[model samples]
Target: DKKGKYTVLSEKLTSEPMGIGFKKGDKELEESVQKALDDMQKDGTLSKLSIKWFGTDEYKK
Candidate 1:
């Protein structure tokens, strides 16, 4: 099941996800971000982005 653009590419070549780093005392911002991510998933925007970048909708899981 682990198949996608990265799998199709050579082992030496692969992309990585970006990590979000926030300073302390940003709970409100973090909550808003979490809500935004949830909304994006609900609206299929995340899946669209994944497909646009990876050639397949691998983020639906």
Candidate 2:
């Protein structure tokens, strides 16, 4: 509170992106994952899943 009075505060949370970590020599797995993601996006599955999980389709980025 400012001046001993009630005050409303608002702020945006900063965070980093999280992803799956893999061991060395996992190029094939990485490529597969990329392909799967691409397919999902092309087929609208990704957006549907995002809406289902996040309550909004904010995964286009």
* C-alpha lDDT score of every prediction, in listed order: 0.76, 0.75
Summed backbone clashes in each candidate are 0, 0
For candidate 2, report its TM-score.
0.64
Q: Report the Cα lDDT for candidate 2.
A: 0.75
TM-score of candidate 1 relative to the true fold: 0.64
Give TM per candidate. Answer: 0.64, 0.64
In terms of lDDT, the poorest run of 10 residues in model 2 is: 7-16
Off by over 4 Å in 1: 1-17
lDDT by residue (1-61, candidate 1, tens digit) is 6566454542335566666777788998888888998899999998999777767776667
Q: Residue by residue across 1-61, what tens digits does model 2's lDDT show?
A: 3686874334324446658776788999988998998899988898999777656665677
Q: Which 10-residue window in model 1 sums to the lowest lDDT?
A: 5-14
